[model samples]
Target: MPAPPPSRVTIAFCTFNGAEHLEDQLASYLAQTYENWDLWVSDDGSTDNTRAILHAFAQAHGHTRDIRIIDGPRKGVAANFLSLLCHPDFPRTPCALSDQDDVWLQDKLALGMAEIHGEQPCLYGAQSVHTISDLTSVGRSVGAAPLALKTISFGNALVQNVVSGHSSLLNLAALDLVREAGVPQDIQSHDWWLYLLMTGAGSRVVVSEREVLFYRQHSANAMGAHQGLRASMLRAMRVFGTTYGAWIASNTAALRRVDTLLTPQARDTLTALENAPKKFAALKRLGVLQRYGIARQNRFGTAILWLAVLLGRC
Candidate 1:
C-alpha cells in the first residue's frame, strides 16, 4: 500500500502593520519544502497595507491550500497569538507559530515535522539566523547553545524561555493542551508562557541547533534581538527595575489559573515559589529559590535571578 499522506501543518501567523517585511515572510512560506500546510493569519488592526497584502496572498494560494485571515484582539502581540492558538476553528494538527517580519528557511516545516512525533504533547524550537533589516546576515541567534534536558523543568521555565515562537512547532497534543489551558488575558510573552505551561504540564520540548529562519532585526520589532552591550544594559535595567518583577507576577498568576493542569511536582514548585520567604530576608529568599530548583538556563541568568529575588524584583 502507498504510504499515508503527510499530516497537514497549520501556520498560526500574527500580523500588525507589517507592510515592509510582510511580503518576504509570506513568500518564504510559499517556498517551503513541505508544502502540505495551511495559513491562518490574525491581523491585529493594521493601519497600513498589511491587510491588502494578506488578502492578495490568500487569493493567490487559497485554491491550492487552506488560507484564512481573521481580525485580532488589538491588545498586543501575546493576545493576538493566543487568539489564534485558542481559536475555535484552529485545526487539530501540528501548529507553527510565526511572526510577521521574519523570513523562513525553505526546509523549516520539513525539519520541524521530522523532529516532532508520537502521541505526547511536544514543542519544537530551533536556532535562527539573525539578520539586518535588508536581510543581510549578522550571525546566528543566541539560542544556538545546546539545550540540556534537565534545564527544561518548570522551575527553569519560570525565569527563562527556551523556545522562540517564530521557530516553534507544537504537535497536535500540544494544541489540545493549549486549548485546555484557554486564552489568558495578560501574557507578557506568548512564547515564554508556552514554555512554562508545556514544561509544567509534563510535555516534551525538542530544541534543534539547526537554523530555521532569518530573524530580522529592525527598529519596528516588538522584542528585537537581545544581543550586544546596549541590549545587555537594557536587560539589566529591567532586572533591577519593576518591569521584570511585574512580568514574573503576571506569569505566576496566569499559571495559577490553570494550576490543576500542571504535574504534581510542578504544582508543588509553583506553590513553594509563591510562598517563598520575603525578599527582605535575602538569604532566606535565595534559599527558597534554591530549594525549589527555580533557575535560569545559563549561569549568568541564574545569578541574575538570584539577584532579582534578593532585590524583590522577581
Candidate 2:
C-alpha cells in the first residue's frame, strides 16, 4: 500500500514594521523543506516598507505558494496573532505561527508536521537559537531546555509558558478548539494562552528536542530576548507588579468562558488558582499553587515563582 500524502500546513505570520528583516524571514519560508504549505499574514498597520515587501513577495511567489495578506487588529502582537488564528478564512490544516523577523530552518515545518501528524489536537514546538538583529549568533535561547511532557499542564501554563509561538505548530483540532474559545480580552500572550487551552483540554503537547529557528532579538521586539541575572530581575519585577495580577485575572476570566472544555482536573486547578489569592496569608496562596503543581520552566524560575506567590504577586 502507498503511504499517505503529507499534511498541508498553513503558516500564520503576524507582522508590524518588520521590514528590516522581513526579506530574510520570507526567504527562509521559501526554502522550507516542506512543500505543501501556504502563508497567511496579518499586518498591524506597518508604517515602513513591510506592506510593500509582503506584496512583492506574494506577487512573486503566488504561483507557487498561496500567500494572503490582510489588515490586523492593531491592538498588539498577541492580538495580531489571534486575528490570524480566528480568521474565517484560516485553512483547516496543521497551523504554525511565524514571527516577522525570525529565520526558520529549512526543516522547521517538516519536523513539526512529522511529530504532530498522528496526534489529533496536538501542539508541537521546539528550541530556537538566539541571534542578534543582524543574524549574528548569540546562543541558544535562554530556557531552551528540553520540555518534559510531565511538566506540561494547565497548572504550569498558568504560571509560565514553555511553548514558543514562533517554533510551534498545532494540529487542526487544536485550532478548532481555540477558535471555539474565541479571542479573550487583555490576553497577555497568544502562545501562553495556546499552551493553557491545549493542555487544559487534555490535548497532547509535544516539544521536540530539535532547534528549528533563529529567534532574532532587536530593539523593536515586543519582548526581546533576555538572559542571565538582568533577565531574572526583569522577570521578577513583572511578576511582582500589578501587571502580573492583571494577567492572571485576564487569563482566568478567559478560561472560565470555556470552562466546560477543560478536563475536571484542570477545571479544579483553575478554580484553586482563582481563589488562592483571596487567602489572607501569602504563604497560604503559595501553598495552593504548589499543591496544584504550578511551576515555571526552570528551577531558578520556579524559585522566583514561589517567591512571587509568597509576596501575593503571582
Candidate 3:
C-alpha cells in the first residue's frame, strides 16, 4: 500500500529592504522539518541587496521547491501583503506568511498545518520568542498569552488583534474567504484585518500556545514588538491620540465595504460601533460597548480603550 502524499504548503513571503537579516530567515526556511512547500515572494522595491539575495536563493534552491518572485505594489507593508495574498498566480492552498527577518522553528509549518487542516474556513496563529538583532532571546512577547476560543469574537477583533500575521496560517477555505472579500483599502495592519475578516465571516480562529518563531526586533523593523514599558506607553498614547482612531476608522470602513460577508451578529456589532460616537453622553457610549461585549484583552487596556471612546479617540 502507498501512503498519501503530504499536503503542499504555500509560503507567502514579502520583502522590502531586508537584506541585512534576510539570509538568516531564508536559512531557517530551508531547515524546516516540513519539506513539502513552495515559496512565492513579492519584493516591494528594495533599494538594497534584498532582490539579489532573493534571486540567489531561488537560483540555488529552485530545484528543491517551486520558487517564484514578483514585484510588489510599493504602497506599504500592508499593501504588499494584501497584494501577494490576492495575486492571481498565488495558489489556493494551506498558506503561511513569512517575515523576512524572523527565524521559524523547525515545526512551524508542520504544527500550523496540523491545526488548520479542516474543511471549513480556519485561521491559525501562534506565539513567538522575541529576539534582538543577533537572535539572542530577550523573552516571550508581552501579552503572548494563549488565545481562548471564546475570546476570538468579532467584537474583540473590532478593538484588538490577537492573531500575529508572521505566526499565522490560513487553510484553503480561509484563503477563499479572503479572496471573496477582495483586497481592502487603507488597512493599518494586515494581521488585524485578517482577524476582523475571519471572525466577521464566522470562521474558526485557532491559536497555539507554543512559540513557533523567533520574532526579530531590530532598528529596521517595520513594526516593533509591543513588549516593554516604553512600547506600552506608546500604544496608550496612540489610543489616546488620533492614530488609534484612524486605524479603527480604516478597519470599520473596510468591513462596511464587505458587510454581506459578515455574520448577522458581526454586522450588528459593526453598526453599534459606528454609531457609538453619536451618543451624547459618555455613559451611553460605554453602554453600547458593554452591550456588544467589545473589549481589549486586559482590564487596564480595556479601561484605556473606554477612556479613548470618551475622548473620541476610538
Candidate 4:
C-alpha cells in the first residue's frame, strides 16, 4: 500500500505592516518538511507593500500550495486572528497560528503533527528561538525547565498565559472547541483565551521540548520578547493594576456564556475567582486563589501573582 498521506494543516497568519520580514517568513513556510499545509492570511489594512508581497507570494506558490489572502476585521491583532479562526472557508483540519514576522523551522509542522495525535481535543506548542530583527540568534524564548502539566489548568490560565500564539498548533477537536466557544469581546489576547477555553474544557495541551521557530523581536513588536528585570517589573505592575482586573472580569463574563462547556472543576474555580472580590480582606482573596491552584509558570512569578491577588489587583 502507498504511504499514508501527511496530515493536512492550515496556518492562520495575521499581518499588519510586516513587509520588511514577510518574505523571509513566507520562505520558511516553503522549507517546511511537512508540505501538505495551507496558508490563510488576514491582512489588517497595511499601508506598506505588505499587500503586494502577499499577492506576489500567492501568485508564485498558488499552484503548489494553498495561499490565500483576505481582509482582516480591522479591530486589532487578536481580533484579526479571531476573524481568521471564524472564517467560513477555514478548513476542518489541524490549525496553527502564525505571525507575519516569525520564521518557522523546517520540522515545525512535522513536530506538532507528531505530538498532536488527534485522539482528543489537544494543543501543541514549542519553545521558540529568540532572534533579533535580522534573525541573529539571541537565546531560547523559554527556559530549560519542563512545563508542568498539572499547572496547565484553567485556574492558572485565568492568572497568566503560558502559551505563545506563534508556537501554538491546535488539533481539529481543539479548533472546534474554540470555534464553538465564539470570540469574546474585548479579549486582551487570543492565545490567552484559547489556553483558558481548552484547559477549562479538559483538553490536552502539549509543550514540546524542542524549539520550533525563530521569534523575531524588534521595536514594532506588539508584545516584545524582553524578559529582563525592567520587563518583569513592568509586567508585574500591569498585573497589579486595575487594567488586569478589568481584563479578568471581561474574560470571566465571556466564559460564562459557555459555562456548560467547561469541566465541573473549572466551572467551580471560575466561580470562586469571581466571588473573591466579595471577600472582606485581601488575604481571603489570596487564600481563595491559592485553593484553586491559580498560579504562574515560575515560582517567582507565582509569588508576584500571590501579591497581586492579596492586593485585589487580579
Candidate 5:
C-alpha cells in the first residue's frame, strides 16, 4: 500500500569541502519535477564556502518546507549521514542521500515517488551518468527490481558497485533497517554500506528511469575510475587483499559477536560468509581462471596482483 497522505521524502546532503560543485547540485534539486520533497544541507567541517552556498539556498527555499541547512557532527561521511538521519529535526521521515558534487535529474525523485506504493520505505537503486569528461554508465542493468538480494549478490553486486550513493533514495523504514544493521564507522563507502544494509534488510532497491546524479570526478574523490588503469589497479589490489582482507576479517569478527543483534535476515546474510573462503579457494585451486591484462580493479589473485603491480602500471 502506498503511504497514506502526509508523508514526505527528505533529500539530505552531507558536505565536507564541496563548494566547487555545490551550486550545481543545488540548482538540480531546485529544478526537480517532484514537489513533495525537502532539501537538507548538513555541513561537516568545510573550510570552504559550502555553508554560505547552502545557507543562501536554504534562505530562499527553507520556509517553503523544501530546504533546510543543519548544523551537525563533522565525522566521516558514514557518520555524518547517520547524524543527518538522527537529527531531531529529521523526523522518522523518508530520505534520499545526496553528495556535494553531483547533479540530480529533475525526475530523480519523481520516479522514486512512483515506486512508493506502501508505508514501507522506498529504497531505490540509481544508475549514474559518470561524467569522466563525458557520461558513461558504469555497469549492466539490474532489471525490474534492483533490490532483489539473491540476483544482486550472485553477480549483480559482485561485478561492480552498481548502486551510487548519490543516485539512491530511502525512506524511514529503510533507515530503520540500516540502523538496525549497525554500520561501522570505517566501512568502505556510503553506497557500499547502504547496499549491504538495504539488501540485507529486505528493503526494495529500484533502478529508476531517472538518470539523475552526475558523479563529479577530480583527484580528491575518495575513489573513482579517473585514476586510469594503473592507479585503479593498485587501489584495487590494496582494497582486495590488504585493505579488504582486513575489512572482511574485522567485519567477520564483529558479525560473530553481534550474531544475536542481527535480524534473522541479516544473520543469514552475514553467516553466508561461511562459504566465502572455500568458494574463493576452490576457484583459485580448481577453476580455470584465465589470465587477462590486470587492470587495477582485476583483483584476480595475490600472485597476479603483485605481478601486475611489478609490471610497472597496467
Candidate 6:
C-alpha cells in the first residue's frame, strides 16, 4: 500500500564534494510528484563546484522550498546529519533526511511520508540500487508494503539498523523521542544508532521495499555491495572484537547526550543492554548466534555471524 502524502516536510540536505551530480539531484527534488517541502542544504566546505551549483539552484528555485544554504565545517557524515536534525530552522513536523548523491524517484516523498504518520513515530525504510562497474541494476521495488511492527522488537532491534538517512522520514513526535535519546555524535554511522534506539523506543522501523531512492554504489559509498566470503570473514573478525567495542563506546556516548530524549521503551532497551552479561557474548561481543542479540541463533549461527561480522560479510 503506497502511503498517503504528508501534509508537509522540510528536506534536510547535506552535501560535500557533490558538485559532479549536484544539479541532477536538485532537479530530481524539484520534479517531485508531491510538492510541499522546503530544502535545507548545508555545504560541508566543498572546494568543488558544489557551492556554485547549489547557489544557482536556489536562485532559480528560491520559492521551491524556502531554500537555505548554510555554513558547515565538515564535522563528518554522522555529525553533519545531527546538525541537520538539530538545526533550528527545520520545521517541527515531519522531516526527511537526504543525501547528495542519490537520484530521487518522482513519488519518493509522497510514498515515504504516508507511512511516517500514525500513532507511533515510525521510521520508513529504503531499497538499494547496485551500480556494479557503471551498470545500474534494479533492486527493490517502490510499491508499499505493510509496516511490520514486530520486525523492530526491542531485543531484535539491538543488532542491525533499518532506517536509511537518505530515504527515511521522521515524524515530529519521533523527533521528540530522538531529541530525548540524543544520537551518538561520535558513532560509526548515525542511521544505525537511530535504528537501535528508535526501534527500542517503540517506533516502527517500516521496511518499505518500495524503491524510491536510487542507492548509487560507487567507490565513495560508506557501505558497498556484499563482497565475497573471504573478505567478509576478515572484516567481521576486525569488527567483532576491537571494532565493535569502539563503535559501541562511541555510540553509547552519543546516546548519553540524548538520554533525556529517550521514551520509556527506549529507556528499557538501554537498561537491557546495560544489564546484559559482561562478556556480552550474545550479540554485542559475538556477531550473531543468539535468540535475538545479533541474529536469532543458537551455536552455529553465532559462529556464522561472528565470521560474517569479522570479515565485513554481515
Which should have the higher TM-score, number 3 or number 6?
3
The TM-score between candidate 4 and the true structure equals: 0.94
What does candidate 1's lDDT look like per residue over 1-314, in tens digits? 99999999999999999998999999999899999999999999999999999999999889988999999999999889988899999888999999998999999999999988999999998888889888888877664246533467788888777788889999999989999998887778899889899999999988788889999887766364645666656666678888887888889899999999999999999888788765577787788788888887667667877787777777
In model 4, where is the ten-residue run with the lowest total lDDT?
141-150
Report the Cα lDDT for residue 64, model 2.
79
Candidate 6 residue spans exceeding 4 A from truth? 1-6, 132-135, 138-150, 180-183, 224-238, 263-269, 275-314
Candidate 5 Cα errors over 4 Å, as ranges: 1-7, 120-122, 132-150, 154-161, 181-183, 222-240, 250-266, 272-314
- Across 174-234, the per-residue lDDT of candidate 5 in tens digits comes to 7766565554565556666565555444556665544566776557664633224554566
Work out the TM-score per prediction. Answer: 0.96, 0.94, 0.96, 0.94, 0.72, 0.79
**How many pairs collide in each candidate, listed in order?**
0, 0, 0, 0, 6, 27
- Candidate 2 lDDT for residue 311: 67
Model 3 TM-score, 2 decimals: 0.96
Alpha-carbon local distance difference test for all models: 0.86, 0.85, 0.88, 0.84, 0.59, 0.65
Q: List model 3 lDDT by residue over 34-121, tens digit each.
A: 8899999999999999999999999999988989999999888888988899999899888999999899999999999999977889
Worst 10 residues of 3 by lDDT: 141-150
Give the winner by TM-score: 3 or 4. Answer: 3
* lDDT per residue as tens, model 6, 1-314: 99966477878889998987777778889889878888888788899999999888888889545888887747788777766676666667777778887778899888888778786777776664544434376443222222432345545445444456677788778766666554355677767766766765667777776767666666677353333454345545544556665665566556656656566755655555555454524445342224234452123334654564444433
Better of 3 and 4 by lDDT: 3
For residue 104, what is the lDDT in candidate 4? 96
How many residue-pair clashes does candidate 1 contain?
0
